[model samples]
Target: MAVGEEQKRSPREQKMLLADSNGQNMTALFSPRFKSAAAMAGWDEEALLLASLVVEDTPDRDSKHKRRFVLHSKTPPTNSSRKRRSQRTPQPVAILDLDEEETPRKDSGRKKKGKKISEGSKVEEGGNELTEKNPGVSSSSSVLPCIDKLREELSCAICLEICYEPSTTPCGHSFCRKCLRSAADKCGKRCPKCRQLISNGRSCTVNTVLWNTIQLLFPQEIEARKAAGILNGRQQAQNLSPESAFYATLMNRSTPPSGEASGRISRRNVATTTSRTQEDEDAALARRLQREIDEQSPGTTTRSRVHNARMRARGGISTSQHEDAALALRLQREEFMQTYRGSQEHVSSRLPSSTLARANLRSMASRAMNLRISDRRR
Candidate 1:
């Protein structure tokens, strides 16, 4: 095949060829992911297979390309209509442009050539009006109700996500295929979105137009999810119950650790049984006993006694070292106080009272001696 032809081959064709070569039958072609075994109606074999690939694998389509490729039915547009509009400016739709519904002519079991009026009728007419207030019955009521009923039936049970090839469980509830498969995986093939028994084995397919409508309404969301991953619930248990998960993560971030650590996990920790094994307790006991023996062993002992020595050393030297440290600390503090003493304090300690009293006595004695000498000379 030419490179271009090879590149354009649909995934369905590739899968089909692989299955046939491997000696598998038609039933193998259709799976939880692949919706149909038969080719798409109105499309050629190649087109049909391409579409299947698009649906099955490229769950997420390129957004830029979609503006040109996929047209959703929720939006009422046709290619011809778009082309027509493109040729001219688009015009607003007029309500008056709608045609009136035609009234049905009833046969009286015998053919009548002329119009006959009922006894209570106001005017001569071909048929009597069911209600005088209304001129004719309309197609709106019949057409609209069917559309509404379809919408209600197509909604998904889980995440209320739109049902794509929705599968119904024994409980009569429905979910998208990707959604249910995910639920099956996480909750052990049980419905995570709903507590339904998936193993009950009763299942059903989604209505096609309803499936198409979902594709239309949430094309981007579906495609993004498909391209990224199956949006179905393999949803972490936390996501299935968001309120609990959020508070738990928040609490975990804020929580302080126990003797476990300084900053503890506040969030609800979901440690697996295997992650915390029975052997852990035995290992812990072994470690504790080993440590006790090592601590009792002396520094004179070799490295075999290290664990016990280190642990026993915890309080063994703490007290003696602490007392010596405290004494050295007090002596250093007193030396600092003496070395840093200020001039004002030194002067105040040797202040006036005693010196002043002695100076006053010396002056009085000198005055008495001088006075005695002066009296003798006279």
Candidate 2:
């Protein structure tokens, strides 16, 4: 046979070839026990010989490919009119345009027949109009009630409509994101259905199945809801001053663009985002610790310890002896403070807690104590 030409085998020959290959220990190729044993024993002369034998014993491409190629007999063309006549179910009929093809009948008998045909055409046209107006009336009238029932089950309890941004609770109950968020904010972090405690820090995820179902069933409603939501959000945002809007734009822009880095930043600062009040409490605790250290230790040791703690808290950055590490540390702290201040100023009402109420207390208190001592000396 030519090198490029495919080898063809008869049915009998193909059957025998397949049977011979199947009779061999081809099961070992797929066996987990054999794979594990091979890994433990490692490849050797014996193993290599066995592999070569197995490869040789395996069925060729022609044999495997032959099994997949099915031969189907061609079906004869079907007559549309005959098929339509045979079918018992009624179908929407297309009205024919007869103005172009219609010819005048000169004979009186033929003219009478033409009038009858015209009357029948008028009756069919009326029927087509009725079907067009109430399309799928017979088939879909029964289905609509079931769909409305399903929509009721899927609707948000808070809104009493199809759920927007559907989110399911851990209790298997679902609600719209806005509705759930409103409930969480107004009430506690409790499931609306079961009253089970949900963590305030963790937000609910979108219910994909229910969301898709709602979209498929009530596409127009979903589109209208989305447009309304967009308008409302825009109006709310516009109600904010130019300065607040600009600050928000800047904050959104400052977030890391890379998805991985953004994810890491979000994960690392989750505690910070969860509670501005809690972060304030932690900072207060840190300052108290710093003051106690300052009083107990010498100035050099106290500063060094504080530097080390800050570095650790910030995820320590490495610096060579040539680089001014102190300046870099000061710059990072300043940047962090500025970011905090910007965010706090933008959402002061929402924050409901002072993140920097005691920001410089440690340094200011110590300086005042030193100033009093100097005054006593004077």
Candidate 3:
């Protein structure tokens, strides 16, 4: 029936049918599907040769028109074509004779296929083994050791633990705020690591950057450290004696009746109180010494004597006071000599004979001279 339909066609109609068939054949030849089919069939050389012949036989205008039509119909759009081109393996340029290329091409294709299969299998086995061995391996697990190291770096030197409520000193060292505060209270305002002067922990600011990083990396550890600190504080509070606890409560009070918002006494106030007490004691001692001096020298007034005694005690005696001291010493020496002479006279009177009296007087005079010499030396 198809042959009868062809025979019944007019001459012009027959020419049109032939042209249409030719056009269709040309489109197929140039299409990507035809090229891929030829490559898969291992007929690259034959396909190229056939394409060359057809291209040579077709007129330039008809070939161009047909190629355009084939591209528009059978080929993908530009974007899709680019994507396919990227995905497609590049074909090597054929330079050798067909006979020479055939064996090598077949062998190479087989070798490539075998290598791809082996490599794919090896990769699948490796992935499966990893999954089986370490099912928990993930981004978080991988970062754990790094986080631990960072925790060590951010730990307090005093407490030897991760810092809780991290604070920074002037010397650029960081520590747990509670640890630093306790150290400052016990050992003065000094850094534990560097032994440099630091502000008290109460005055020190939190290291915001280091604190944030520590919080991000070790939230649970920070929470644990904080909890431990709270427990320790509670334990210490419980251990305190009632009197000590009461004193501590008084010291910590923010608002006391005494107009001082800081309930604790300042160093300046303590020093001033000490000095005032010392001055009062010194004045009392001066008054006692002046009373003794006044009793020895009846002419001096109490006020002048007290002032003089105080000045003398302070190593700033005047010329007049020095003369008065010398006169007092002279008077004491005279009185001693008179008493010694009177005692010697009484002892001589008690003797029975002139010879014994003379001997006793000589002995007593020697003794008195010796005592006088000793007193002068003193």
Candidate 4:
């Protein structure tokens, strides 16, 4: 169907079902179904920036659109930060009350002696503070990290490092799906703050901003972690932070290396234990895979359809168990030979006709020759 027709369809028609962790099935809404009731179709970044600037400057929605906004700032707006907390009162830019052509003549010496100075000082001190807000969107933190800035800085948003299976929320909040899921456990699948119900799991896209941030800030750290097979949970990452290390070193009178973190914490963060335990799990996985490979019948098994249909159609076909087994063995041997051939090539390139190379080459050539002889005999 065309994209337009697809859009008009019910979200239910496009929903996909998948098994959740509990082994029960559930429906997930997909993105692209969002209906924009207010904003124009083409919300270019330049437009958004301009809107942000307008919000920065004007700070107030016209009274007519008041109810439509989730939170509206009531104070006057400005292009700058207001008075510091230490100051007596906040000052906002006064409304431009002059005509466009007016130019007040400067009279420095005479005015320096007048009550006009006191009047001007009082007027400036009494100006109201400017507050900016998102219309129909509740303010969380007024000075939020900009989305572009986030994309530019972080390598990963959800993990707050490099992204892995990141899922965005409806309100544009994001977490690694697993991380978000973890955070959701502390609250729910919905965002902890917005509470917007994300219907489709797939449509929740990546937060390019957060991902970029991690890449910029910790490129080498990320590479080392990936190389060392390390995956950090939020807690572990938090504990490794500068503030935590600072306090720790100060309290101990010496900096403890991250490797020297408490054993209990390390054990809790990483699932691996002694090397012996890892070997045991490796053995178990090997056995499981072997059993799985064996459980599936060879292509020649009964009820399978590897037999040539065209030969049967031509009424020129006859088959036997010996022929089937020979074919299967030939294929399997070819696969084994191919694997050994790669290893042989690598060994040859790395060594000058080394003993290992000679042995592997001989073994592969012998298998190939035997297979060819067997095929000739057949």
Highest lDDT model number: 3
Q: CA lDDT of each candidate?
A: 0.41, 0.52, 0.54, 0.41
| Poorest 10 consecutive residues by lDDT, candidate 2 | 88-97
Query: What TM-score should be assigned to candidate 4?
Result: 0.29
TM-score of each: 0.18, 0.30, 0.25, 0.29
What are the per-model numbers of colliding residue pairs?
14, 0, 0, 22
Which ranges of candidate 2 are over 4 A from the true structure?
1-143, 199-201, 242-378
Candidate 3 residue-wise lDDT, 1-378, digit = tens:
888655545543543443446555554657788667768888865557657646544553354456568778565445543244234322211112344679888898778667755654554455456567786642222243354566578889888887877888888888888788898889888898899988555686678767766665555566666657655764576478543332232222212332231222342344545544443443344344334434334236776567557556767545465565547545644553454345446645763222332343344345445543543343
Give the lDDT of residue 123 in candidate 3. Answer: 41
Residue 86 of model 3 has an lDDT of 34
Q: Residue 214 CA error for candidate 1 (Å)?
A: 2.7
Question: What TM-score does candidate 2 get on C-alpha atoms?
Answer: 0.30
Q: What stretches of model 3 exceed 4 Å from their correct place? A: 1-145, 229-378
- Which model is ahead, 1 or 3, in terms of lDDT? 3
